[model samples]
Target: MGSKRRSLAAKPNKEPKLSRTDAPAGLSPLDWQRGLRRQFGREQAFGLENLGSEPFFSEFRVSNPVSKSSYRVAIRGRGPGGNFCSCPDYATSELGTCKHIEFTIGRLEKKRGAKTAFARGYQPAFSELYLRNDGKRRLHFRAGTDCPAELREAAAGLFDLEQDGLLPEERFGELERFMAVASKSGHEFRAYDDALDFVAGRRDADRRAALLGQVFPSGAADPKLLAVLKAPLYPYQAEGALFAVKAGRALIGDDMGLGKTIQAIAATEILARHFGVSKVLVVCPTSLKYQWQSEIMRFTGRHDENAVRVINGGRAQRQKDYALTDFCKITNYEKLKPDLDLIAAWAPDLVIVDEAQRVKNWNTIAARALKRVDSPYAIVLTGTPLENKLEELISIVQFVDQHRLGPTWKLLHEHQVKDEAGRVTGYTGLEKIGQTLAPVMVRRRKSEVLRQLPSRTDQNLLVPMTEMQSLHHQENADAVAKIVQRWRKTRFLSDKDQRRLTCALQNMRMSCNSTYLLDQESDHGVKADELAALFEDLFADSEAKAVVFSQWTRTHDIIIRRLDKLGLGYVSFHGGIPSDKRPALVERFRDDPGCRVFLSTDAGSTGLNLQHASTLVNMDLPWNPAILEQRIARIHRMG
Candidate 1:
């Protein structure tokens, strides 16, 4: 016991450095060329990696251009990384230090160097940190670092060899491991040099296919159902879908119109079939909630009169309670937060967050609400998962499956490669996850298959503001700016105070004609006039059928008057429109050419297709980009 205590006090066996778990020392550029000349003669060769063994510093030389005795040294390491051959300048590690690697290669390359980032395929046995010759700490990475059980026998063998001070098999093994680290360190530095040459750009379809193929290994998929997902998988989508289900939480990241919704739904259906899962919960933007419910019924052929239930009525709690009894309930994100407890308690087999990017704010009410329920599986749907910042993807991925990728923001971002302009030029885990997830995910782009879609024309009709509107707008704009600035400087506020601020902003914008007339409920006279004029033009003749969309009840009232003035029979539709009256409005507009105008708001924008009218005007543009897309989708989407 005394000896053990004394030994323990002396020093725990100096532990080996575990790779990257410890931050690497500032790896200043090493004078590879000059250092190499000092270590070896001028005959050593230069290149990437000689074989696969750790790269060694190649000792090569070129006679200095200016002097006979003077020599330019080339010291390049041979290891797991690549190679960095340096040429020197006045600075100790300058010129030859591979600035190209730091500047260009750094863009595409991960800080993990080249050899270790792909390490998830195996586990490391132990992670130990040790000081290097420079008194800086370094990490040594080996497989199985996290092994719970210690190999005492192996440690004893290593200890015995150390005591003997003679090289043995164990010594050789340890030496090879150390050399491997050294080689990777230098090689990764060198690899950076070549990486700089490849600038980031949009990946061609072929590359995406290859990457998807690499992600979803053959026969790794285990899907639950055979629902009809959007066609033309392009291999990547299939792999991504499967990976999402397998990982328990994942996002289908195809671009917009690329069938992310379908892939997500299919993955959920598959999970339901494969795992005896009977219930799924889809939370999406309010505009897409109903759309999801309808699509789920259509693709799964489960469109029995009561097969899919959309939570659209009553208070959010009531809808959430109703969802508790319905195995598969579709709802929107706004309601998701308030009802998360109920949703999670349902223990949904699948919880799919469509337009999942909206949940990017980890601290929002929506995010905080997600903690209430348990979900065995989760899927995030987004076309631009890494938009604005990679953290957007991080929050989303964390919501779906905590461990699917490495559990931290740093690990996820470490795998990201961006171009000079910072778009997500390349990704690493997206493919690896796809390999493990293809059976469940099915990502695809529509451009690959939809040849019949018409060219979308967004005419920038730059109309000048009406004079009265312009004057009101300028006055209101100044007030709004002032309020915002004051709000920023004046801190502390209650929830009520915050709401007051929000209302003030709304009023400011409305007073200035900055808001859509539909949103201008606090009574803006200018909006009233705008609505009246638009409708008079819309119903100049009885045959001129049109749909007027506004968020403001006041604007709807204005529209009603102009319609009354034209002696045109028109119907008003809004969320406030009685549920029984909604269908009447739709029927009247469809059945009667005399019903010259259909006035409604965002609430009237779904479940009812209005392709009968060619001229659709936005009385007020919605702030939410998705709402704008959805509003147009009701009219322009293929029937």
Candidate 2:
């Protein structure tokens, strides 16, 4: 018999580690010190008082000549260990050194040129480097190796050098030309274009602020439309609308419960009235289609006949609606593919895509379909634009303003950190990305506008598992482990095994809800009893209402049974119900005072108005934290 051979998968390639000497190799301490002196003059380094120390250790209060930020520097034993600065540059660099360290070493050593430090054949070239928003809301520049004193003085004269940074933006042609001519000997312009872009954006923001004051003195574009709005917009909402108008094509990335919908509505009115944009297309989650319709009517005071049309019905009806060109149209992302050609033909002046993260993956059919449609202005709305990687942000940005960010390749290179072998290690230059996004994105947090929002408190309640629940959970876990073992032995799992595995996990989760779910026995789980008792107490005291969220309909079913047993008036929403009936359910839950509880799965979480219910209960938690936020938002949005 032939011997059995074990198959193994290939291991991933390892990235090369950087050496301590690689950055300043072939150059001595003197060369590095000279480079430092050229970048930040001798006076700034020695201007501070040196706090006395022992032979091995010393301290100094080094002040940043540009930013005027003071930092303490300490030197340890010798070489690399002795070179330490409190500044971020020293701590973050792979070389374990900074200009501060070089300056200190230059002072410590008495005979600067006693050793053969400066190489005879060494040559120097000038390169201009610009760092954007280095957490100081200021731009920093580096004039590069052996750069002339004339250009350095010119930069300091043109722009106020804050500690070691630049704050002013004006004519830099002379500086740019000098750097270009000097760098022709072979050096790079480090983030020079990005710096220029940020300067122009700042100027635009100033102009935009002035224009918005003139346009919306009383808040919204037209006071009559503002009068029609269901509730007055908070001050921040007005600011966001004005920002969107200035951006033309933008992304509203405000956190959930900050009223992105109302802000988008206000911006839409501005586009129509100011820019002569008559046709508007709104693409949103299927659940939110009617919600958008309701918001438009409430805010615009435009009835269904004349103002907003939600594209629905069968293919023929959808075609008819798509053909109509005058009014604002609302549709879901899923419907875009089926009626892509007609929607494109409709030729919307502005397109607003809600829950915009749905298009994060560019390879999806929906994303590709949305891209094909031609719209002069587009605004995407999402609380979490980047769910995982930087690529997701790029995808959303590409949809909003494709040219402003330049090529995807260039953006990725600027932000993504890579190791020696070209593997992505991590990310950097976040502040730079923030600067680029400043002009085209509006972000607000609930914490910043705390006065406008109600205070919230969170409590965690734990219920012990019942004996029956424990037994079922353990049994299913063992069965799942055995199945996994079999799959390992076979090196593959069939569709049947996959289904079996899924069902096994589902059984375990259901067991958590109630062992009765799996066994159909007379006895119930402790969680159900706890849930029953809590609602019983809440009802006994006051007229309280809650929106309870769960991941499974089976859980919802068990809760419904308990609520029924408690004689509590309750409503339910889940995937099993027809989509057309959901609106009625939401309305009943919202308006019906006697409806004490709304039982729902994940489907009830998005774009629903249940703010009348002050409390939220999660019977079972979803895997993603974002889903929990969405569920809470249903009861937490502005009136």
Candidate 3:
């Protein structure tokens, strides 16, 4: 039998074996015969063993006679690209066949007749579902002759089989039904799952493309909308406004000092003019309520001065404010719970949430309250939307579009990388998540739009006073008011009275920073907390460094303590530090990678070349604008 097998293999190369039609395209009959001869030689030379059981009957183990090596070949289906072999030649050669596959095929052909072998290798064409990105993006279905009879009957009226089988974009419900039938009937539709994924991906891409067209109609913003705005928007800001309007609900997570406030205002205006989005509701930090009101009044040319109302005071007063039909109403997040029903009743057309990271924890009362407001349009503004974890971002995004990221459990399962102990170690599939968020979330770093930014951009962040700080501030402020009133009435001041007035004013300023700065005891103050929060964000980026200036050395002392708690490195430059030692401190701040902060009193504000710092923070405002400019110039000067 062995000699007969060897002679059979050698005879194929000498004779004209099969016709030219039997060979694959582009091969001569003699060449095809020679190739068949090599395969026959391999089949006879190697040892073939069945790896699969009688019922499973697909896998075979082919052993190399010379090298003593072996490979497993699996018969998946019929013909080329159907079977798989654990061989380098099969993987690298695009022909989709190897010696192992040929040997397996020869065994099957011998067991079954030549007619049955040929019939098994032939695969008929089947129905295919694919995406076509022509003038209109739509799903195209091709019904082949081999399409299942049950699938065709199920899709009889739903799809036009006589036509090109073009599925309308609006008939996705019918498409889902058809897919269900096809899936249940076990029909072999090519690219079925991939077609579904393509539909979802194209939905997001369509949204983005539509927004782009609206934002850049004729390659620019609508002139009519621009005419209604009091202030001219930077090109990117205008795009951001239109993006928010186009998304209907979005998260504007531009970096700090990037004018998220202006973008939100612009979006509100665009919605008002183009989409009949009136009754704007601005929910922000308590300290920024007035700022929002001011911005609305400043930028909204169509809205009068009386059109914007800041909701504050007690419940009755807030309810009255909510009752008003003002074009814009601004309120704080803290009041959401008490006035939740009132807001629901008011039903503003658009809701703007500033510093939206406050709602990063979706389970929190503030976040839930904001989510319950149920506005048609939402613009969430946060400089640091994702401060710590992936969940924080998901939570914030939930407020804008609940279904944008799909279910929380599924998202975490797919992206969250866990350890042996089930603790989350890191994340994966971030690029996919980003693609999912591209339609609803708009985040721009300062570096991305650097050309549109001015040489210097100034932003004033109003930090609310803590409970105790507010009490102390109110007391000193009242005392100073009394002193001023008495001086105005009499037009004269005694030395003791002037001294008392100065003390009161100074005490009020100190209380704004921290009670420790005033009494050297209490550490409760919002400014220091806000500074620490800023540093937390700044230091998140390795390249970020800041020059923090506070006029009072005592303020620096409190901040330094906080920095120590955060385990951040810093160089302090104040009058207390000897002049001779200042340069070395500067050198350390400049050269040391660990030092991310340059904490300074006003003494080092001038004549310092600390251009390495990308950010500058003022703990408290200076009395003179020149002094503020000097503090900014320390980092903002020419490189």
Which one wins by TM-score: 1 or 3?
A: 3
Task: Give the residue spans of candidate 1 off by over 4 A.
Answer: 1-248, 304-306, 312-320, 407-409, 412-639
Across residues 1-639, which tens digit of lDDT does each residue of candidate 1 receive? 355434335666742332332223453223333233233322223222222232222223333333332322222222212223332221122222333222222221333443443232222233222111111111222222442223323334343434322223234336334434534432221212212211111122224345435543452342312223533343444555566655555667664544566667666655665556677777766545556766776666676645677776567655555545565787776776666556655667777777666566777887757644466567777655555555555556556544333334234445667775656676666566555334333445545545533434232112224455566666656765665676678855557666766766555444443334424433334444544544543343345566667666666676676567757777877787777777877888888878777777888667868767645666666789898777776567764
The lDDT ranking, best first, is: 3, 2, 1
Model 3 spans > 4 angstroms off: 1-216, 219-228, 301-306, 466-471, 474-495
Could you give candidate 3's per-residue lDDT for residues 292-403 as a string of tens digits?
A: 7767777875456559898988999988888888888888888898899988889898999888775657778887787678876789988887777888988788778765
- lDDT per residue (tens digit) for residues 494-546 in model 2: 89989989888888888887876786664557666656755753454345688
Residue 576 of model 2 has an lDDT of 81
Quote the lDDT for 243 in model 3: 77
Displacement of residue 229 (Cα, Å) in model 3 is 3.1
Winner of 2 and 3 under lDDT: 3
Best candidate, lDDT: 3
